[model samples]
Target: MAGITRRKRRSTTRPAAAPVTPVADLIRRDFTAPAPGLRMVGDITCLPTFEGWLYLATVIDLHTREIVGHAMAEHMRTDLVCDAIDLAAARGFINDDAVFHSDRGVQYTSGQFRAALAEQKIRASVGRVGSCYDNAVAEAFFATLKTEIGATIWRTRSQARQDVFTYLHYYNHTRLHSTIGHNTPAETRTNHYHQASAA
Candidate 1:
């Protein structure tokens, strides 16, 4: 210990409230769907700025690995997650048999989000705590986002939001994903719909 520099200590606990009814890990790392909008995974990530932390909540279509909905806010409240879910539902991303999966973050477990899911007829699926694999696709998306966005420290929340907005548009429209066969998420989705319509 004479000259060794120890790494800074960080808390391992995820910054979210506990579940109300102890939801089950319905996803169980499947992270797949034969069709678009059938299975969706949602998660929250933090964007740092001098003004404060901007929490970005996102709902991703597991079939195409596309961000179906996103909401950026100053706080990670239940409303934030609800807004993202509502957007996805309004855009017809949640089919009749679709399942919306997430970790049991306090926001996801809140009564508001539960009611929102009921309103959209979407089943709520949750994963066990500390199991990233259960929501791996969402986790991977955030990682890719930060990596591609350069992870720069922003001056304000609006600045970070704008950057994320542009990047998400590019992500859905242009950026190719190896997981989805090196095709853009939008392309994958469009191809599916076009083929279905053609048949």
Candidate 2:
């Protein structure tokens, strides 16, 4: 009895999934909107830490190039993206019938996330399969984050989350964006509202 060994369980393989019919590509690579709340793009990226992986989901406003909302967690579930959208909506950053563009990731395509967007009155837009260019704005944001955050790894997820929080604030309020005439996202947004009010 002391030397007895348990048999290894056989692993089962799942059948390949069918091709997903993605949501319409409403963006068409335009990646721009006349106003802040009309259009947005979101994507998820992973951060490495000794504890494990920390996942971040971000919702960015197209007009000001501002990261309006973001959520960080240990998992990349639909809830993570939904939480990001909810934050944007809660902050009054998303407009009625606004469009949210994302790649055809399962989390973005899943019924739960679509329902969340519908609840928020946000239209869902997805890129074609395997086409990174279709969601270039979101991809560029993550790339810039990786480059500017300058953290290859962290000792813990808490540290990673704190660093990301700081970076997002700096990105919105301090860092200048060349696409927006070298203005910070916060400044661009403020200027837009100021101009509109004066008009």
Q: List the residue pairs that clash in candidate 1.
A: none
lDDT of 1: 0.82
**After superposition, which runs of candidate 2 have C-alpha atoms over 4 Å from their true positions?**
1-22
lDDT of 1 by residue, 1-199 (tens): 0111223323222635765666666677888899998899999888777786788889999889899999999987788889998898888877986799998777787778888988898888988877778788888888788777875567778788888999999999999989899999999999999999999
Weakest lDDT window of 10 consecutive positions for candidate 2: 7-16
lDDT of 1 at 97: 61
The sequence of per-residue lDDT tens digits that candidate 2 reaches over residues 1-199 is 0112223322111121342554799999998899889999998888777787788999999999999999999988889999999999999999999999988777888888889999999999987877879889988898888777877777788888888999999999999999899999999999999999999
TM-score of each: 0.89, 0.89
Q: How far is candidate 1 from the true structure (C-alpha RMSD, Å)?
A: 5.4
Backbone clash count, each prediction separately = 0, 0
User: What is each predicted model's overall lDDT from 0 to 1?
Assistant: 0.82, 0.85
